[model samples]
Target: MYINLHNMQAIIALACGVLILIMPKLLNYIVALYLIILGVMGIVRF
Candidate 1:
């Protein structure tokens, strides 16, 4: 499949959602890491 930005983002979001549901405590870290990675990706245009 031709994976694109939206698809990748959706996958990341889904993974994070699952993690949050599982831990319920690492939510802050998960979200922070997600945003950081996303920000880096955006800056790199990846």
Candidate 2:
């Protein structure tokens, strides 16, 4: 399956939201990692 950039980001955001809801303590790390990954992906165009 080939998912587009928007869809992939949405999925990741949703997953991170769920994880944050489940474990509030990880909210900071989850958001940070998500942003970092998005940045890297944008740079690499992957």
Candidate 3:
């Protein structure tokens, strides 16, 4: 099961979306983490 970077990101986004729907409060943390991850990925170019 080799998942590419894009697929992994998609799965993460889907999970986060479902979690946000279940617990709206998680939105803040999820968004924050997402942004942080994006920044890191951008810097690392991965």
Candidate 4:
């Protein structure tokens, strides 16, 4: 499968944002992890 990791990460981030609205506790970890992962993906070009 030709899956795009960047797009996948974006989708995950979007989902996390929606989830965060329901559960504010996840805001820190989810957004932090998503940003870190997305940053790495962008820098490394994966």
Q: What is the C-alpha lDDT of each candidate?
A: 0.91, 0.88, 0.96, 0.82
After superposition, the stretches of candidate 4 with alpha carbons farther than 4 Å from their true spots are 1-10
Residues 1-31 of candidate 3 have per-residue lDDT tens digits of: 8998999999999999999999999999999
Give the number of the best model, judged by lDDT: 3
TM-score-best of 2 and 4: 2
Q: Which ten residues in a row are the worst by lDDT in model 4?
A: 1-10
Ranked by TM-score from best down, the candidates are 3, 1, 2, 4
lDDT over C-alpha atoms for residue 26 of model 1: 89
Worst 10 residues of 1 by lDDT: 37-46
lDDT of 4 by residue, 1-46 (tens): 5658667866787899799999999899987887797798779975
lDDT of 2 at 24: 100
TM-score of each: 0.83, 0.79, 0.85, 0.59
**Clash counts for the predictions, in order:** 0, 0, 0, 0
Give the TM-score (vs. native) of candidate 1. Answer: 0.83
Name the regions of candidate 1 deviating beyond 4 angstroms. Answer: none
RMSD of 1: 1.6
| Shift in Å, residue 41, candidate 2 | 1.5
Clashing residue pairs found in predicted model 4: none
